[model samples]
Target chain A: MKHKPRLPQGLLTTGSITLTVLVLFATLPGYASIYTVILLAAIFMYIVLTLSWSIFSGPTGYISLASAAFLGTGIYTSAIFGKMLPLPVVVGIGGLASFCLALLAGALTLRLKGIYFSMFTFGLVELIKHLMLWFEINLTGTRGRFVIVVDHITVYYVMLVLLALTILTAYAIRRSKFGLALQSIGEQEEAAAHTGVNVTLVKVSAFAISAFFVGATGAIMATRWTYIDPYIAFNYLFSFMPVLMAIFGGMGQLYGPIMGATVFAYLEEILITRFPYFYMLFFGIILIVSVLYLPNGLAGLIQGWQKRVWGARYVHP
Target chain B: MSILEAEGITKHFGGLTALSGIGFHVDQGEILGLIGPNGAGKTTLFGLISAALPPDRGVIRFKGEVITGLKPHQVCRRGVARTFQSVKVFPNMSVLANVMVGSFFGRPNTVSAAAAEGESVELLEFVGLSAFAAIPARDLTLANQKMLEVARALATAPELLLLDELMAGLNPTEIGLAMDLVTRIRDRGITVFMIEHVMKAIMCVCERIMVLHHGEKIAEGTPKEIAASKTVVEVYLGESAYA
Candidate 1:
């Protein structure tokens, strides 16, 4: 069958505009009342987290398993700082703290390649969790910390701004020389290095930037929830969920992680309510199926189908 | 005086000596051919000189400054670039993008995108792969892949290029084209140190030749000297064939 390769101009423009509107609407006073607004805010936070994960584990093939450690660092730093200072200042401090933590982690773990790198990151999260637990006396008497009640609108707007920044940064990096170096390193490290790329610097820089975004999102997350405990703040599941979303969308492409987070979040909301006990199992099965049949994730599957349907016309007439 | 000098370079892979007390010099604007049988350490010598691997014992001097033990990128920045026997072009990237990586990272003042793009286009045209510029590198045939490798190495603006088996898999026509390309590369005032098994291509383009047998230098001279050397003939054809 003959097919025409028509670019979906309307759909592309509308989809982008719709996403912007929806994001901005989340900051409105009466978008969906306070409860749904908070839920949407949480979704935005996940979007940032998933995209941050994509910077290293997705396109760069680093496969970090300790994203939660950076997230926790930001959450705890912001929560404690907000208790003593202004919220905006606290968020900035959170980003700095996370950057330092990531620098330390990167220095120690960047030398370990492939699966060893992954395991080192996994151990890092566990170490952070244990340290938080062990140093209970230093962390708000071990019961966790809380921020004084502030306007929820402030939290919403802060997260919105942060999300926008994260997306823009991801897009910029995707098109930059640094991005090409990262992709080359991911595909073949030895080749990239021989080609004059500083493979170590590129990998570490991506990891650090990835940590910055996830950490910033984690800071706002603590404020939005009005509490921060190491258990919930640095939950291993927090790291797993974003990695899953990134894999579910498409790891290497910019928009894939965001799409993955949206679909995964919506699915979680629907299925968790109905099969709360089997929710993790459902996630597991979906991951298995996705990995087996759609290795590039849902976005790639859709792209493949689109090409098959429309690409015929572009061939020799 | 030599532009590049390798003095007493020895490499050991545990108990195995890959290169033993090898010394050679490459004059500026000269094409030096390195020839050997398999496992004779031609590629390893390239690696050691290019800083892809550190030699166990060596002092490499470029422009009268020691460059031994420098990292590959640092060596490249010092005007030394090399290709692998196995082609190592960034497989998933477009041909232009692969060359752009070289221009952007190996050269200064290449941070501007327009300059990088222009230089990359020039390099692709120089290597006769301009028509395949937009194609992914993995799609190129072996000969084109080898050409792309050379093009990418050239993008670094190196003073000396180390090409490993640039004509290994090419047919006679492709070999002729590659030989002409190497000559043009030399004419650009860049020194060429090439490792090749294609005897005709090596003799046709190289001003001097060095021979390695089991990681040791057995012969070094012009092509005629090498072709007449009893040691070179015996090493390649064996004692029975030489007899």
Candidate 2:
């Protein structure tokens, strides 16, 4: 009857792996080439994005595509304010702006379930993108707001720290009472309500937390580029890619998004370098095959294999 | 003291009347049986009382507090827990974890995961599902799934437990076990409100019976009185042969 894992072996293993990765990442800039550092920074950005998606949408099955809404809010906040403020302050503003947007969206759409919820969230990004474009043509001239570009190495270290914080926060949430409540809502909203879970409160809080993460990533990344148009800031690519990567890695587990982001980021870099014109086509083909074979994501495939070899002994919750 | 009091409870779904002017009271520690033919408003009545749906007309009181318009979770927090007519276990979670969710969310005194787990294990044992605690709920047999539902519902520590057809697909032996479990639940000081099609179990176990026909309360009495009532027999005969 007592089936509690007194100490979570899976969590411990995940924590140790995360720690090792963190240590290695911290030491990278000392000896690694500038290209390696830049590439890793971009990879770290991807990890933050995918994990942000996973933390809210993965366990809850909400299928939110509102990342660009949050991401663009952050980017534009930084773009408009970066020149007058400190880098950390600008990033904080970006995060706050995105969190505000999430509160608005969660209030309006958290009642929607399944495919309707997905479409509404998908529409949210599009809504933000178009509104920004409209504002630019009607008021602000063709050129978008100017940005303050920080040094690449400083940006790199900041990204590493942000990525670590996002993951640690995500891991902590997955094990907390908040995590359990959201996941219960994910599994069965009615049942969760019946069990005394404050469904609206849990969901709205999760939405804001996820938005804060993506917003911070977007705010920091916005300064790295020379141009800051609505097109660049509110790219649909950022909106959709994190979702796909999280699904690929196994959204069910906390570490799943990290694995997905890492693999896809490197694969993207290699394909762009080698295939140039045909990279997306190759990416599409590879992604299709992986999704078809590993329906539960890469983590699921690994779990299934581990279960077979280990004879199904104490699989993680 | 009455655990539940319903007055003039009525529900309509776009002109289809589900319940109308149905009044009932379930006393503390009473085992009340609810029976009706399909579309007889039994489940609809349950839904209104449990706060899954709001009544078009009437008031529902639980432990003397007006709970008619409360949300389902609010109702649960006030000590009402229910099982679905269909098996509604959290499929991906372990049986123990599934029960733990209820205790963790529904019990104010359970402050830690370990405490919830210990309490949930006890509930699981009470419902005879202790051996399957670590297994995912999806893998359980339907009969055991019913038992798991009871354990999960019990984890809420409800003053009134509304069981929606817990014995529908159960074997005869399983039904016997279920009957015993229901009695034990009452013995543990929880009021029981159950909807059942198994006449033998309902007749033998419930202290009283309420029959609904076309959203109207046509009969309310002890099991033997219900069996002998001409209106009850006529209502069942109009729909189909009574089980």
Candidate 1 per-residue lDDT, tens place, B28-135, comes to 889999998999999999988888889999799998999997887788878888888888888878888888888888764456777878888999999999999887
Compare the candidates by lDDT and give the number of the best one.
2
lDDT by residue (B1-243, candidate 2, tens digit) is: 788998988889998999988999999999999999899999888888778899999999999999998888888878999998988888877888788878888764545777788888899999998899888899999999889888888888899999999899999999999999999999999999999999889999999999999999999999989988889988773435344
Candidate DockQ values, in order, are 0.52, 0.64
What is the Å distance of residue B77 in model 2 from its true position? 0.9
User: Model 2 misses residue B141 by how many Å?
Assistant: 0.8
lDDT for position B8 in model 1: 94
lDDT: worst 10-residue window of model 1 chain B? B234-243
Q: Across residues A93-204, which tens digit of lDDT does each residue of candidate 2 receive?
A: 8988999999999999999988998899889888888899888888875647777888889889889888978988897798787888887888778888888788888899
Which ranges in model 2 have alpha carbons more than 4 Å from their true place?
A1-17, A139-143, A304-311, A314-317, B108-110, B237-243
Give the per-residue lDDT digits (tens) of candidate 1, residues A22-124: 6567547565587666666777888988998887776568888878998898888877777788877777877777778888889877978889998998988
Which has the greatest TM-score?
2
Docking class of 1: medium
Q: Is the docking of candidate 2 incorrect, acceptable, medium or high quality?
A: medium
Stretches of candidate 1 off by over 4 Å are A1-23, A137-143, A147-151, A224-227, A308-317, B237-243
